[model samples]
Target: MRIFRFSLLTLCLLLSSIISFTLYAANDWYRPPVAVSWYWQLNGTVNENHDVDLYNIDLFDSSAELIQRLQASDKKVICYFSAGSYEDWRPDADQFAEKDMGKTLSGWDNERWLDIRSTMVHQVLLRRLDLAVEKGCSGVALGEVDSYRTNTGFYFRQDDQLRFNHIMAEEAHQRGLAIGLVINADQVRELVDYFDFALNEQCFEYSQCSSYGAFIKNEKPVLNAEYRRIYVDDKEERNSMCQNALTLQFSSILLSKKLDGSLYKPCR
Candidate 1:
């Protein structure tokens, strides 16, 4: 029998290369470590020079070429879409029956909560996933996923929400895409296992930062957005918030509530 051998240094280098290659191959999905900076812009022309690791952009608005550009620069892209809401402005809006829509989202005129359990809604969302695939999105950030927590004019048991969320995760994974839950802190524990990341809004301001502790503990990135006017101008307040976020190991930013690319502040 022939024996094959490698020196200690050669073996270490080989193992390091294997680990790097595994991570490189898994670029189809995002699994960010603690404190990864990311950018979220749902409106206006995407400002692609943020020096961030990830870009969450509107799935319908971002062109495939833009996504390819970001990936070419070694950045991951997470396509944004309402998984549990109906947006009348979307290209596929006409596909949703009026029955599938619930009350208008309080602040947004064009958005309405969706009947998450409806079969038609599922089909529409499946098509959205297909769009994400065609755009070469590394993953997706599913908005309004915790619809059961709101008065959406549709009855939803907690288990119904869980089932819906699980299916979203399963489907995205099956398509080789990672999935994130947005502002759905209530089910962090329940979904931490299924979701690749969590996108939170004002969790620190609401004293809800601790809700995503499980995500940090799991080594999954928690992208928190703080819209406080203070964060945009007051250095002391902004520093304090950043300190708290850093302590929590969260990747946080201060932005306009519009998410219109009007403001951008990342907690280092």
Candidate 2:
């Protein structure tokens, strides 16, 4: 009887350990580690042979087959979409109402800022999230989330932006998808806990790269892009820039301003 009791206790302890480990793993879900290699191709043909850990591509432009192909190669896909802007070129563009759109983007004529507080906009963004799940994307990179900081023509404040960003992160996680905070560097301290990773543009050029230290502190990946012509044309400068990126523990890439998959220099 004594031997049987000891055996039972050991079994129980082993089972408990297994269960605890499983729960810990399940909690990790789609969150990528810090400094994960990635390919950010929002335009042109997607070359999946880049041998990267993650691929950030257009949610609307990439076909389901392409995303599946990447997954077959054991790569994770992060779909990109403008969550805070209404682009007239998208298939769902007509769904946005005139009242929900604010000011047009400074350089992009076809795109306009969205009223992040609008019910219609929320519904649209939710639908987009659903599409990401349907397409088998492991995560999403929500662009234009910092419209509140711009002259969006709406009476938006920081509080409104925080609320909207929280809703987005909650919705993505509830659907079993990771969400990447894009370019709202100012909100990193507030939204870091809510997001899985981050993608930034021109932060290195504009001296805003330090804003992403919160993500580094949490061991989340911070993928940055530098579009300055010097980074592209000069090899010595590119090498120096990449060293700086490495010191910062950022997975940095030097790409064209268009992000057309033409030039890719990863800081390994």
The model with the greatest lDDT is: 2
lDDT of 1 by residue, 1-268 (tens): 9999989999999999888756654554657677888999999999988999999999999999999999999999999998998888899999999998999999888999999999999999999998999999999999889889899999999999999999999788777788888988889999999999999999988999999999988989999999989888799999999998998899999999888998998887
Q: How does candidate 1 fare on TM-score?
A: 0.88
lDDT, candidate 2, 1-268, per-residue tens? 4554458889999999888766654474598999999999998999889999999999999999999999999999999999999999999999999999989899989999999999999999999999998999998999999888799999999999999999999888877789999999889999999999999998888999999999999999999998899987898988988998999999999888788988888888
Q: Which portions of model 2 miss their true places by more than 4 Å?
A: 1-28
Error of 2 at 223 (Å): 0.2
Relative to the unseen true structure, what is the Cα RMSD of model 2? 7.8
Question: All candidates' TM-scores?
Answer: 0.88, 0.89
Which 10-residue span in candidate 2 carries the lowest summed lDDT? 20-29
Please report the candidate that would top TM-score against the real structure.
2
Clashing pairs in 1: none
* 10 residues in a row with least lDDT, candidate 1: 21-30
